[model samples]
Target: MSLQAPPRLLQLAGQSLLRDEAVAIPAVKELPRELFPQLFMEAFTKRQRKVLTAMVQAWPFICLPLGSLMLTPELETLRAVLDGLDVLLAQKVRPSGWKLQVLDLREVDENFWSVWSGAPVSSSLAMSQRQTGEDCPCTGRQGCLKVVVDFCFGFPDIVLQEFLMHVCEWAQQRKELVHLCCKQLVLSVRYVNEVRKFLEMMDLNCIQDIEVHTYREMDSLEQFLPYLIQMKNVRKIMFRHFPGCIYCSPRIGAEIMWELISTFRKLDKLQKLHLDMVNFFKNHLQQLVRFLKNPLVSFTITGCWISESQMDRLFLSPSIHQLKELDLTGTILSDFNPEPFQILLEEVAATLEVLILEDCWITDSQLNVILPALSRCHQIISFNFCGNQISKSVLENLLRHTVRLERLNSVIFPVPLECYGDNFDHIYWERFVQLRAWLMEILRETQALRKPEVILLCTLPCLTCGSRASYDLEPSPCSCGKLGREP
Candidate 1:
């Protein structure tokens, strides 16, 4: 009997022959492609450096898995992977003109990698020390191509050191090209020192947007203060972290909050500021208004607690008087004070085009306070008041005020509850129908005047044992036993 070739060897020979061919592009989108990352991990776990390197070379795109590459059993494999990435990046032609898009180093964590691989930290670092490589192929090529680097929090010191060293190597090889294309940088507050060292290597002037995020409470981020103040061209700055209780840890949160606020002073071109899971107090409120480059165009604060006094100061601040968009979603307006918000609305009526107050616990009295000023906000186009405690009357009045505003287009309102003594009777379906009809009538009249369609979204009521319920769009059963329609 003739001996047949082994099935595994045949597969290997097929892959090898494809690699040797000048145009051996694998199926980039087939179901089998999804197995590549798993195969890479398995190869790393088994200490198969040659197989890993071969896989890296066979990778159709330039998704250089730096973390997995660093885990290779042989230094030659690491070097080979880097060299392969450089070669692929340098090439300009492909069947489809797709290029490398994301360089994800977020997995470069020393402790986690060490624990998962059961390897000593020192040995891993020593083996992974990189040498200066040749320039990137895409370098010096004229194109609008760019890449986004994931440098968020929780990465270990050693990984950051190696990553920054590689970055320095890339910059040294192709300074002008990297400078022209590397306009976006992502940093983390968790690893501040690594962040500082990485920033030291970058040309901060070339950076247009810096996205900084944190996973836990950090005592200080003062290390980034020096570099941030110098990024004059950065038009957008975003600071986001894990959400914390809006009312807890007032003192500790305020200090770090102050440090973050102080950094915004000299950024003259900073037009947009987005803060998430950040705590704010009355004192730190002005730092936002003080951003006087071109009048703070947009400001967003979510999952934060702002005292009534602070809200007062924020709305009345002349710095943001010409602000175009303001969002205070997920903020506790517990005091029910509407003067500051009302004044803020009145001040920016001409320029304030979007206002969002979702989940603010805004009562009918509070809504009533702002109704006059809100109605006068002729430029206000998008308004979201979902997740509040307003009644149907307040909503009707709100629609009446906004109807005359020519720029009004989108409105999101909470579903008014028809409850009696802690039990939800119905969803006030008739009131909602009447409100929608009124809005439609307004739209029809405006259509005669050549206006756009007004989009409205109403929060849904609870059909299951209706107490104060969650958000949906379905109408609930009413005790009145009448269909929600015009008679």
Candidate 2:
């Protein structure tokens, strides 16, 4: 008697699990028959009369699960069905713990949208799904979700209510969220009242791991912050760039700064914040410097033009001392003067264990001045500088200086080509091998720390953060140990 097979489905998570959440879940497609299917078909070919029996004997799916994230019906239905089958088969499997938290925004309040416009927001629904004749799982609101959809996806009205409505609806269902995620979807301003209503449902202790995207509005973001600070469970808040803003200016207003600190002050249980694109104005660095004094794990300041004062606040802000990982790519190195660049390295070099600077203008000359200061930062584990204009010499020098660097990229280490074994391209391969070998020589001799992997996401924020979204923020973390590793 052959063992039975479990029904299978397809999803894209860590290991291609049967499912994950909507925000993180990718579109599902049928499993490729070439690999598993063909093998299964062949095994059952001799048993046409028992095709179903053979399928029942084979493990027929992939498992890529996101434990805490939520998913939509379309994605979840397929996953649940397959997961249910897996359970029936009693196979060795670990299904995802993610559930469906689809928020339905189908109603409207248009008056307020005319006032506030263009807010940055989450790309997915903030609250769980809504339908008529349904009672709330958390608050038991029947037949009425209180807040209706205030804006369409592309209309100007959409921008106004995006943050306010999405947050309000999401907050209304807070009791259901045992897991925290930084999330919001602001589509229009008419939903402002909806958000205002959400504040009334605040349970500071219940909020955890909030993810928010900042927008261009000078007043709107500041307006609703009071509600955010109230959520006590929020441990980490991620501020992302809104989807539409890609080519806009990289400056910010003063109100944004004040409100950011004010919000930070409220999160008592908060341990990490991922702020992206908080522009530095001369006057505001004073405030920012003050804000960084608070303890945090991770900090990300991407794609902003920092005034000298603002730049100083970063170094002076005692926050750098506490942060475990620091990402400062996508920001201008002051096309005005490279001196600030040097100052930046001096400020963050020693403290940053995990460092990322991709596609930046910091040349070999600049890094030469910067990396040596990091000699004391023995914890420095991972470092990435992909797409840099740095010369091989500068790279070689950096490898020598970073003693504990476990993970490195770009100029970190070179890979030899198999072409050396071939006859056709041996000449080119020979030159390539010689050059890369020299690079590898520096890599091995430096004996930099030896982590296995690193990621490269440091593109210019004007490009990384959306131009339309222009929701600027500074991301910070309280993570522990080193930057990244060699890949």
Candidate 3:
């Protein structure tokens, strides 16, 4: 009953151009400036090597976001682009229309391509105007073209590794003409020496985000600290599987901690910090918090345990008072006194947007203690308290309190104990359905305007599949749960 529409005139022309690379290659110089992006996208996606290379050499835009088109690392395409750059560099006098300065190898600028490809003529013109108005930092500097990239050092892809090696060598050959800027760097401990060598060759000041994953490496963190201290412009740092002093002496451990804290002092621009499975900092957290020079916008400490005193010190720290995102997921706080956490909530309530306390084993009494401070967070957009134990009445009270916070959009809560059977592995289906209906009713009655997505999570995983079951304001069960319901 439906018919397929014919291809647009532009699409047919692009296809015809792609059918013959020789003609397309020569026509790039005389082609309309607006057609470059759309045609380049088509050539790049279809792997028209010669045409793609020609377009790169004669590109009219200041930035060529090649990385956006590269969904997977393709060695041949990269080589062709580099070859075009080689031709561009070899020119004694660049073409009048040639404006390429930044070859951004980051997955960005999708809208630029989309607008030029099929958007309205007005949108395409507007995009071209905006691109013309934007200025590059390396604009006027002689022979100072920038090549921006994000590197993940430990990925197990040989083609990607080879592609990066070629790029590195190319940049090294033209160091004066090319500025290789790495914005986000993820380093695995196994490749510390290689990463160090790479970092030494590039400008460290260009790095904005860095993540270090030490997979139980005893001395990797210490070895990397010297290099980390030099990244003064880094805005965020994350440490995962950060080890303790099980393999080294206490004095050596203290020395490493001191070195780390010193590195923190050098990163004055740091605004976000995450430490996951990092038990080594439990004893020195207060000192670390004291050394932070700037107020953090996000601080996440997951899968690590710290004492009540350490938490109290953290709550009192001025560096975290204005936090917008706070995550304490999997950090046991069942034994912690509620006063410190309540105070922390109140301190950050005005700015807090995302608060995740999943798997903290919080009890009904603890929930009650912090509910008042939690309700005052007017900017809270997402709140996750799954894996805590609370009663139906307490959860109802919690929902009622959150109703006044209009910015709340998502809330994940633990299924009340009243919905479970003698043990958590078995669920009372009838009770769960009734309790969920009641909670929905409460939200409908209390919420004046916006209604947040409320999900009830059962901590126990399904016996058939290892996935935990969650109810989204409805009794719809997971696939495994549906089998259990068969009569």
Q: Worst ten-residue run, lDDT, model 2?
A: 468-477
Error of 1 at 196 (Å): 3.5
- For each candidate, how many residue pairs have backbone atoms clashing (under 3 Å)? 2, 73, 0
Model-by-model lDDT, in order? 0.57, 0.42, 0.78
Candidate 3, which segments miss by more than 4 Å at Cα?
Answer: 119-143, 242-252, 453-466, 476-479, 482-487
Backbone clashes, candidate 2: 73
Pitting candidate 1 against candidate 2, the one with the higher TM-score is 1
Candidate 2 ranges with C-alpha deviation above 4 Å: 1-71, 74-199, 246-259, 278-286, 334-351, 403-433, 444-487
Give lDDT tens digits, candidate 3, residues 1-487: 9997887677677888888888899998888886788788789879889998899888988778888788877889988998899898887787686798778787855666777666544455543443321233344567677888888776567877777777777888898788788878888765687666676776777787999876555477788887788888898998776243233222237788898888898799999999887677778877887788899999999988788899888888888989999999988889989888899899999999999998898888999999999999999999988778789899888878877788988888777888666656667778776877787788778756677765455544455675566767444454667312412
Summarize candidate 2's per-residue lDDT along 26-62 as a digit string, tens digits: 2222323323333323322222212223232233332
Consecutive 10-residue window with the lowest summed lDDT within model 3: 242-251
Best by lDDT: 3
- Candidate 1: residue 288 lDDT (0-100): 61
TM-score of every prediction relative to native:
0.60, 0.51, 0.91
